[model samples]
Target: MDANSFLMGGGGAPTAKFPTPGTVVGGHITEPPQVEQQRDIQSGEKKFWNDGNPMMQLVVTVQTDQRDPAIDEDDGKRRIFVKGQMKNAVADAVRAASAKGLEVGGILRVRYTHDGEQKQRGYSAPKQYEAHYTPAAAAQLQNQPAATAPAAPPAQAYGQVPPGVNPVTGEISAQAPAGLDPQQYAAAQQNPNTAALLHQVPPQPGPQAGGEPPF
Candidate 1:
């Protein structure tokens, strides 16, 4: 029978066969773990399938320089699926590397085990799996410089007023000279010696009229 006949007769659907369990792969971490939301391709809907899942992912580039013909010929990179529990492993690796963490050139080893079958429709690979990371002793691992701390800015002391400025918010205000008492300072601010007088009233002509006109 044809492909459709076989499927209708309960033979099986076509699926991509993956490597068996207990396969080991070695590679350098080309991409660090980043938390990203999983979304549907067609409908653009978020997919949260796993319990206690963070939806983080990483990528590994297979070491082709090890002279392995299989890896050298085939595609050298693969995307790793990360879950909440697996996030711990990634954290440990990063902590071990210190400043470098899981940066681009860090080396790692992974062991493959059967994860489960994918139930999503129109997915070619039904029998999906995941990778388990381990510290690898490779020459490519290098230490990165530790991040430097930022310098602290100078702060003004409380209640210490600056020259001709308010102490609280650094605004302009009238100020008395140094070593002056509080009451003296207030008096000096209220009454200044060099203030200019605008206008003056002259004494009226004393009793100009004989009948005291409009005193």
Candidate 2:
């Protein structure tokens, strides 16, 4: 089996649970939120609400503060399964952060505030939640990594000259350079020994690097 398939054999991160009111969990979102249909625990079948609509839950995986020893092992990751009012609260928080939607690297905090009113007998009241969000930039500032010196450019290979320079004479080539394509070679031939042909390639930005949580 491939590495990914082998890793998938292990169970996912533990689901964050709110045992009682006033429970709070705060962390950085590790990935985009996922919407999945709810399933029955006993039958393992898809579930629906009373109105016959499919029941769905928003799953958000977070790299949480290491405050809870029970589930903070390994990578300190937790999966939050949100539905009902909790989903709405999370959406509002994301909007308050000026984000179009929940995104990876954003900060999120959720609180189990209280229980909703119970309308029928023999039924439990629904749990209610509140949430807040901080954009990635703001969160980075709060837990900024130490600044490091910029890296120097890599040295060119020996005997490997730049496009416009001749290797033997170490001067501008009067003809098209060795590595140019047909089009570029044609253009170079038309403008040989000109400073305009000696273009300096711009440096490209590398992928954004992720930092370890200060938690």
Candidate 3:
């Protein structure tokens, strides 16, 4: 074909099978409100859409007070459908957030694109959209204080100890443990278990030439 005809008709429309138009949405993720699974009509096999893949619908709480027209202040939230077509996009977003040490509570922005008609075996699937996510920096994340190590539990005062026997030393001084007399208590305090053992003295000879037998 001629160059002009090739340029005009051979290539056909530049956007014959174009990507669906999309919009950007920014918010924090929430649990999905609903889920849907589909099966093929002809073969009765499991089937998914959105470029032949299933999607996860996530409800997101949009950042309010930012005056973004895309966000509905009255609703304060929006929904995003994530699918396999945007797998790399979602992974990149998650990696970005992870690199920043962020998590589910972190802010993210997603580009949502709608799907065209798809029909099979006299069955027509409803229109759907897919999400492509990106990490969104927020003032909240930036201004959050670094987690302090619980202030080291406020170093206990000099003589104030927990109300229990010391596990390491195995010492118990709680009211002398019931049945011991004051002397026994003192002795037990000096040597734990001394009160628990009985001692017996054997008989000794009366005396030696210059020394009394000590018993």
Candidate 4:
């Protein structure tokens, strides 16, 4: 290769010392009213892309009298935007709200507090704290005789219903149950032998009784 000469004559164009003709990626553009969801790390936001995705966002929802187009979100999802070094803000916010029982649709406002640590209170009181060997309140738990939960429509005892049984209507008590089922209570009543073995409400509806949803 000649140091001074312009053309050393290798027919093909020589490669530039510094990169020339910057790399250009080929992509097809879609028409309006269509979008693809993608994460945006630069702006610390999650968004749906439209067309070639050059713009940050587009007006997705129709304008309503209740809300201005400026604040209306493009999709059904909430506009969860976090800027300035927000890595786990969304996840932390969701967990905190869940711990406090604030659901997704419910409006929850978050305020930070800088309070110093304080005393911790226990759930059971009067006997504010339990000693290492102390027994629980219920005499039945103390006995621990193999028992079943209270049953529904429990057999009436003493013409007046039991603590868990509603006297007027045969409904099981909503409060803590003595036994697991209606049958168990009936068994206890019919054969006094098992009366002391009953332990829970049979018919007060809850997650256990409710059928599971589609997985």
Q: Which numbered prediction scores highest in lDDT against the true structure?
A: 2
- Where does the lowest 10-residue lDDT sum fall in candidate 3? 10-19
Better of 1 and 4 by lDDT: 1
For all candidates, what are the clash counts? Answer: 0, 0, 0, 15
Which portions of model 3 show Cα errors greater than 4 Å? 1-22, 30-73, 99-103, 112-139, 143-215
What are the per-residue Cα lDDT tens digits for candidate 3 across 1-215?
A: 23563677742111111134565655554332233444454895666666978634323344422343543443444433334444345556666545442244456565546654665767544334333333435535665798777643322233233223453454543434345533454454345355343222222234478887645
Give the Cα lDDT of each candidate: 0.45, 0.73, 0.44, 0.32
Instruction: Evaluate model 4: give its lDDT.
Output: 0.32
Runs with alpha carbons beyond 4 Å of true place in candidate 4: 1-160, 174-180, 199-205, 208-215
Candidate 1 lDDT over 114-174, as tens digits, reads 5555567785433333443434434333444557988644333432343345545655454
- lDDT of each residue in 1-215, candidate 2, tens digit only: 22453687955566787889999877998877778898887998999989999999988888876546554455777788888889899989988888887778888889999999997899789999999998887888989777898974432344244554555555554443445543464355346474354354322233356955332
Instruction: Give the TM-score comparing model 4 with the true structure, all chains together.
Output: 0.17
TM-score of each model, in listed order: 0.33, 0.59, 0.31, 0.17
Q: By TM-score, who's the top model here?
A: 2
Note each model's CA RMSD in angstroms.
21.7, 20.6, 18.8, 28.6
Better of 2 and 4 by lDDT: 2
